[model samples]
Target: MMRNLLTLLFPVLCLAQGTNYNFKEAELKARELVFTQPDSALVIIKKTLANSAGAHDTIKGNTYHLYGLYYNMKGMTDSAIYYYKKSLPYIDNYPKIILRPYINISASYRNKGEYETSLKYLNDALTVTKKDNNKTGEAMLYGEMASNYNYMRQYEKSVDLLLKAIAILKTEKKTKQLYAIKQKLANTYLGMENFNFAIDLYKECLPGFKEIGAEKNYYLTYINIGEAYIRLNNLQEAKKALKIAVDGLKKFDDKELIGITYSKIGNIENLERNRESALKNYKKSLDLLLEVKSLWTLRIAGEYIDILNQMGRYSEAQAIINKTAPFQKNTKLNMVDRVVYEKAIAETYSKTNDSKAISAYKNTITLMDSISSAEKEDAVKEIQAKFQTDLQREKNVVLAAKNNALTKAMKAEKKLLYLYIIMSISFIVLILLYLRSYLFKNKLQQEQIKAVESEKALLQQQHLHELELNNAQKEIIEEKERELTSTTLQMANYQDSITQILEKCDLGEITKVSELKKELQHLIKQKDYWRQFETRFNSIHPEFNQKLGNKFSKLTKNDLEFCSLLKLNLSNKEIASLLQISHESAITKKYRIKKKMQITDDDEFEKILSEI
Candidate 1:
């Protein structure tokens, strides 16, 4: 009877095992497709979820997690977070499986720019790592936390966390993860403007990325290295790195990174005065940026417009500016990009309307001030000091352990010495006291050295901070000088127009002379614009007149004025219009100034005035 029952149930057992095997296989296939073919992954995940009813909790949880990954790849972050949270409860009992949902949820919050909330989720994941003693999970959590700190502009904290992650990953022989953390550390250094160090670290990561066959990361490192070189003003090296990145990135469908690479190339071209080539690269960048509706579109649009304006294609510049207007309101727009966009607008309007140009320049300055205020240099220095102190404390802890072991050995030796020679007890006691004193003094000296090193590091950081501040202040002053020049030019144009109108009236015998006179008086009484311009110019560029006069004492007041306009890079036509002179007269005036300054080459003439 028992043998007949076993035979009856044999087919049922095999069918159940087969069903479980198929479910597991489907889950693995979906996981592999989540990033490259999210639609297919979604289809697989839906079927898995439907058929996962009454299955093991691990299977159900994995299916839900795969669903979340599908949403994540689709850029539906909120949906991703929801599904990740749903998976958490199902996988709560399984520490290893639960980590995925926690980490995914944290990434979703990070994408939303809720960095604090992201850290909270990471902390939850950290708890899971501790519970399972999962070193890999701990390292991953540290990397994620470092990323959040980097975004928050806490570079010191970011560096410390990334170092911790790298240490663990190195010990675990996690070559892929070790390289990934190193790349992130390089990025943090890049943000801090430590360009050479960043370049070194980026170079170090490249081989590791290649060894792990992370093709995308390998090329991306080239892009970062390019950026660091660009910041360091090594345009030739920058171009070489970017070219390598461009060639490699073409094999992938990541349009945004490719767009960024093209934009960097555009910058290099623009710097070299290859405006046409720059425009071509910028156009490629803009097209891809627009196709992806990337946030970088506004930034590249600003650059494109600046190039168009430089080429005297005002209509094209204005068209691009108008097209990018809606994106200006996006809160996600980087403040640096906002400044660039506003400066572009201001430059565009300076050609036609002074009032609008002034407004836009003011906006640019305001944005710059906001950026300057947000730097928090002192806080960063304090963080650096604290990090150094923590490192010293860790070293001291190791030293103390060594010292305790030595003291135990010495005590044992002392007992042996006492047993061997009771008569030499006094001599041994004196030697032991002397040795203890020497050890204490050595420890003190080591601590003093550590303190000096910490202080030196803080001083170096402070010096870098001061240099940044000086550069920022110089930038603000240069912008002010530009504003003053525009105001002066506008005043010249206004006075010229008034004089022309009065002359015409005198020639034609206008009927409303009294009304016209009253209007003219009202306009003339609206503050002395030229006086304001001079005062501002002197305040911003305090030694401009003195320096130029000292170099060229033969220059007249009018010659100096022309030189100032030239310093601002005004075109001959614009200068002629501002001075209410004929184009030929403007050219003659420039030649006269050049002769007075003893300059023969046109470029040399402009260079002298610019330096002043």
Candidate 2:
């Protein structure tokens, strides 16, 4: 009877095993495609889910988790969070699968700028890791928590959490995770403005990432190194690092990373004052970032606005500001980007002479001050953390010495007295060495503090100097504008006087009147006055006509002269007087010029001339 029962159940067991194997295979395939081909991954996930009816809870949970990962990679954090939550209940019985959903949900919330909610999820994951005694999972949770703190601008807490994670991962010999956490720690240091340390840590992680076949992470480290180099004003090295990053990142479908890489390239171009090149790179970055709804959009947009303002494209800059208004209001907007955006807006208003510029500048200053304070606090916290770590190391060394002494004492009574003497001398020597090391570290810490303070002072002086230079330039431009307006009005008055004289000569029968009229005609036909005006305009705005002509080749010499007067903020009547045409004719001329330029927008004609 037992043998007959076994024979009947055999087919059922084999079928069940086959279903489980299929689910596992599908999951692995989906995971492989999640980063490089999320759409393909999603198709696999859906098919797996379809076939997962009545499957074990683990299988259902893994499928749902893959769905979440797909959305996360695409930067659709809200949907990612929902799917991650869906997987949690089904995954609760399995520690390995359960922990990932919790952690991933936390990361999604972090991406959404909900740092507090992100932390709560991380804490929940931490509970699971603790319960399961999963050292690796626990370390990973700490790293995730560190990232949340990093985004919050609480760098000290970030560093502390990262160190804890590193400690655990090191003990467990998890090299991949250890380097990953180190990269994160490097990011924190970058935030702290310790570029050298950040660059060193990033370079250290590159080899480890490569060794582990983490191609994405290896490239990302290069990108980060480029950012550090940029901050240090090392453009050559920045370009080299970013080039590698861009070339490597192009092999993957991670648009967000690629977009970020492009943005860094834009930064390099901006630093070089290559406005056109910077704008091009920024546009490329914006296109990809917009598709992903990536948080980096705000930063790159701010940078784009700066370039536009520099190019005298205030209206275009304003358009970008308006478009990104919603992103500005987001609570999770990065503080550094917030400052950049505010500064760009201030520059736009300043260029346009808008009354709101003062308030905008003040806002930028306030944001900058806040960032400076945060940096100072981070520096202090870092020193304290290092001191604490050193103290802990000393305590551990002493404890080890005690254990060694005790072990030696228990070996034999005859040698115990001699061992105690030897151990006492060794303990004193160890204490002396620790004291010397502690003092050296303390001195180094003090020097670092001084260096930070000095750097802050220098930055403040540089900012003041920049403001003064900007003010001087503004004053010079205003003086030139006043001079140009005065010259143009004088020329207009001279022409009016000439016309009156000519009319008087026509009426009177004086013999010299004919010669006077002839002389006036000669003066009017000579173009010497117009040439003087052009020279003065060129003095005030060099390359204005040349640039306009280059951009709008169809514009005639007369059209350029009309545009130049418009650039001086002349009234329509003033413009008509200067051009020796009727007010109606002046308006018609402007319309014709716009037509020739193919500018449909009412403001675009003026905007184009102004930009040129």
Candidate 3:
């Protein structure tokens, strides 16, 4: 394995030795490939520095970049940053490399958690990256900005930059980097409490990791998916996914990941109320941490200790606290990170009934309070300046939140006002529709009343004419003269009145007085009237079509309006109503027509209807 690794390094070494190229780009790439690669990077950075004192400004700026990498690897980050700054003045010509150098310096500062200074360096890098048109470098700069924002807890800004990085990665088609960006996005989503989106991003990363054989990332994706599901309280899915991951990952794998997986498994089992299984998993995680002797893993140890105490396994939990308590003893922990860690420890100690541990916990809390008070007095101006910016940002957030609420309220009010206007218009439309319908019905009723009255007058006149003819009987000339004198003049007057009524009447509306039996029989006698009657009557039976076709086959004029429309299977009421006839009379006339046409009353109307 050592030989193979060195063999890989041989190609990289040859790449470093190529001196014809004035730029030290290949060396930078080789160093970036392995972040922990200080020793191998030393030769190139040394040569670049040697060239710095010469009259070449471009070589000087490049030397600064190489120097930063060498110091960074040695863990002498401050000294490395100082040298890098010292060399930047000599390299005035190489603006492209100058941009990347600032990024390197900023990354070094970021590792030290000097975020404000880091940001200043990042801005320099950004300006340089833009000047050079280095899209990949700009994307890296964006990723760094996103990382910085996340550390500052400016999650929204972080997410925005991360999205920008993803866009750049997509354009570059950097599949592996895109996968890394996806993980960052997923973490940001987790911070924003958007778990569904977080889970989706994590799922997307799996295929990318598989493509690159990135074992760690593939495992992480599985773990993240399980964790996300666990937070959603989808215990069955969480447990199933996590168990598969736990079984698949080897025990001698990445210790932090293995420990985390154990903790997750323990947590899931605990949620299921499987105490024994939970205890076993927790112990497995504890054993791994102890074996690694990793101070970083001690934070996790603190969490497990708390759970163990709750499980009535006080001795075992206490043993862990005793073993890992030394992690905080020698380390230089940042104030905030220290407080959070101590808080985890204190809660565990308080639960375990460990009096000494509890005293230490309380003392630390008191010490933190005292330090905070002193911080206000001693570091007030600097701290206040930092917090002032944070304060202003918070003020802006509050105002923005208020403005959002106001905007939403305004929109709602506008919607309600529009709704009221629409409702008013709708009410007016409905009222108009009702009024129009009522008017149409009233006009039709008036026309029908006039038609009925005309028919009644016609009937009474016919009856009077008949009575006069019957009463003056059997006297030949004398009786005939009397009949003529009494009835002829009256009959002539009645005929004139009937003609005037017919002339005044709407013949279009009053088609037949099928309203009464006498009215119907009277209509059947007139030649012009039967023509109209046949037009209306032949509409009923199927055989009516056969008779009409035979009779009118040679005739030129046609009226489909009355005949064709009525040929459909209509009931007596429908036919009478349509033809301006009474229902009962229409039925009688239909029977008479049926006898004339030779049609059964119900001979499956539609089957015979096809002939028509």
**TM of each candidate vs. truth:** 0.52, 0.56, 0.41
Q: Residues 351-460, candidate 1, lDDT per residue (tens digit)?
A: 64334565666667667666667785465455445434544444555456566777789898999988779758877899999999999999999999999999999999
Error of 3 at 352 (Å): 6.2
Which candidate should be chosen as best, given lDDT against the real structure?
A: 2
lDDT for model 3, please.
Answer: 0.60
lDDT of 3 by residue, 239-285 (tens): 87787677655522445457678888888888888878887887788
Question: Candidate 1, after superposition: displacement of residue 325 in Å?
Answer: 2.0
- Name every residue pair that clashes in candidate 1: none
Q: Give the distance in Å from residue 142's predicted Cα in candidate 2 to where it truly belongs.
A: 0.9
Better of 1 and 3 by TM-score: 1
Best by TM-score: 2
Q: Which ten residues in a row have the lowest lDDT in candidate 3?
A: 1-10
Task: State how far residue 349 of model 1 sits from its true place (Å).
Answer: 2.3
- Residue 413 lDDT, candidate 3, scale 0-100: 96
